[model samples]
Target: MKKVTSDTEQQSLFWLIKTNSGRLSEADIQNFKIWLKASDDNHKAFRKASLLWRTLAYAPTLSEQPKLLEPEKKLRKKRQINSWYAVAASLVICMFITLMPELEQPTAPSEAEIVSTLELRTAKDEIRQFTLLDGSKVWLGAGSRLLVKLGSSSRHTQLLIGEAMFDINPNPQLPFYVQAGDADIKVLGTIFEVQKRNSGILVKVAKGKVRVAAQNQYRYLEMNESIHFEKNKVLPLPSKINPESFAQWRSKRFHFVNTQLKDVLHKLNRYYKSIIYIDDPSLGDIPITAAFQLNQLEQLLNSLSSIHNFSWHKDVYGNIHIKTNESEISF
Candidate 1:
């Protein structure tokens, strides 16, 4: 295999290997994003390398050598030589020979000995889903960051910021734990959602059961149960909740029930590029109960202003400003 010399190819290959190593930090992802957006050539190189990687991942491995006739053997050798030439040509476009040793005889990792750690993030207005090495599934909300560590003994996940829904695989021997701020949620096998709000962390169970521990206390919650935890204290007992509304953002519709105006804006900010400002501090505490499509943010704001007697305007920079109306209210 020829060595990769092009700087772009080399850089793309470097990122490809690092990203697949199952240990990417948040900073590394940000840097990779910047590099990917730097030029079209970089994007092309990365894509080419990714395609090669996929092809290699699907390539078959031989368990034993086979006997063949002289003619068949010569033909197989010729095809193998041609295939190598083709691979070399592709390598010139996107270098991947650095992974030759591993690619030559790829083997699946043993489930009992697997250990991997990686960070997952979604940009503004973006929602993403991932499957962990343990076969558990996760749906990450917009502008969210999650850290996942999978080991033979335990599966750990940290919701550093934002919200995520987990559909965990049944592994009684390997307990699954999620850390959201000060709250720690433990489960054997369950479906649940966790969100980090300005006030505190909220945990909602959709299926099975979970134990939430915070502020030196722990509570067990069953399906359709939810609880909120503040920084220093846990709220009241777990309350019944609608399991259907769990992670509604994935459906492009958000349901807010007696949610504060500030919290609403905080969620909308994840999908909206511009900033939303409430000029009157008093308005931030207003409780709102509504369900709106993700794309109807502007309409939602308009209705809120009209019902709450507030006036709103968008600046030249696309930022929105909401203020109390000076005129008298008819209602």
Candidate 2:
């Protein structure tokens, strides 16, 4: 792979693609077409420049993580056009290997198949953002799964599995809805968090209000509020939410404000798959108030140990063992 030594070459390559076939004058297009016909490598060079331009236009993230500039998906829909973009991208991109020497092209997809599906997924440990075929913009949490559909068929949203926080784009003409368990949360244009707990579900509203109807009952949860739906009823009026405490997730930290011990453990189990055993059922009822950065599993165990006489053990793989030897803690 040759290196693009200067910014001038880079800009020229950009202009080649920015100035598309339709953008050029017919006479100029004929002259350029003649130049392209002169030699095989000339066609190759123009193709590379054109592809690089288009790649930059579509996935601007390449500027930051330039490594992803390669078009891994097969160019099937517009085969002739996409192939030129891919090939041209490869050529100009190869030049940057010298000065910005860290860049390397990714492995090409096995074949070109014009892969287009509304289903959204992310590589492990990677977080992604994308607009659905519908006008909805979804911010998928790490390891989250999303399924959406759009077009004249009408707009709809379903939280297939895992956790996601949505900044939904509203359309009174096309109301957006989310299905979580038996409940259906309807919102026009609002920001909210929907987490699927083991038993039922948790809904938190940030900006606008959300209408939550579950199991034949419904409630309008207001801003800065959190509600849990369990046993076929929404929990009594939600206490005022602590905005900062909930934010621990953004920092990879877990926050609990009088959160039940059992519920706290559930969150830990989901985030870190450690075998947890609460031998003393009473401990599950005890309320926990603390903040923790989940980077260290032992740190959490140590915190629990401070308030209760609980035994904890762990393996090399971060599997945790929690159990109390006695029937109840001796206060």
Candidate 3:
């Protein structure tokens, strides 16, 4: 804490931590690996600054907004807009977001820096909850990011990239919103989850309703309903059921219903912090209508192997890749 790194270097480091950390590109990771090894103090510096930054950022949240995220995402959400507002207000009393004295954000030097714009980012192992000006709650999945543009009359939250959960207080006049990739989830008041997957944007609604519309066509899902919107086409909800089991991943239970093996594996990689590979393209398409606890990785593998005599290989770093005659490997 006594040594001072240049402000520019600090900004770059924060940006990198927020935007790339766990999701670093192969080349970038290699570069980071080299850099980390170049100095003994780098790791210590990053750990300290990152913790301070996260702790300090919460001051605005606790003093400013409401707590709306569901515990374990096991929220018992409401359908009517009024009910949603009521629930959101109650969570604010819980006050999960608090500031530590160590983190005092750099005071804005100019009016240009004092705008209502939000530049949000998360690091490799960081999990943060942000309270917005409109009493909306956001949980920044690790290695994810988003930015917001606020105006006098409107509240706009944009997912520049990555995954997030929103428990919004419906201000019909203000119109709470989120944009992921090219698609946007808009509602006056509702709760939803959005992820930027390799295949498309995964959008799921927990409470009230969400409108997944692109082009001229639109699809609306009532409570516990969701869908995937990609390439301007809104497909039937990815599966025919509520994917809440997958929603509250921090709880350590991974849920999927008729989800393909490959897709399920991807969820594991994302939440469990494991690297997984499927042997064949077809393997990903195989249906896995099951619920798994992350701690039960062996149990999951055993169950899978019984399904197809698949051989699973795990490395020293907790990464598991499957390869075998029964298993056609694809990462």
Query: Which prediction has the highest TM-score against the true structure?
Result: 1
Per-residue accuracy of model 2 over 151-258 as CA lDDT, tens digit each? 342344567655667787766655556776776776734788787665577788787777665543344566788777665543344546876644345455776667
Backbone clashes per model, in order? Answer: 0, 6, 9
Model 1 lDDT-worst window of ten? 100-109
Cα deviation in Å at residue 53, candidate 2? 67
Cα lDDT of candidate 2 equals: 0.58
Better of 1 and 2 by TM-score: 1
In model 1, the clashing pairs are: none
Instruction: Give Cα distance to truth, residue 317, candidate 1, Å.
Output: 4.1
The weakest ten consecutive residues by lDDT in model 3 span: 97-106
| Candidate 1 segments whose C-alpha is farther than 4 A from its true place | 1-114, 326-331
Q: Between candidates 1 and 3, name the one with more favorable lDDT.
A: 1
How does model 1 fare in lDDT? Answer: 0.76
lDDT of each: 0.76, 0.58, 0.59
User: Which candidate number has the best lDDT?
Assistant: 1
Candidates sorted by TM-score, best first: 1, 3, 2
For residues 1-331, write the lDDT of model 3, one tens digit per residue: 3445443344335433433336655444444554445456656655665564454333332323335655433232222333544455334322222211111121222444333887888765456788887678888776678987655555666786567888887776565667777665666337778877655787777777765544323344566666765564434433455455436654656666677788777756655666777755656777777776777987888788788646787777777877556545443
Error of 1 at 63 (Å): 82
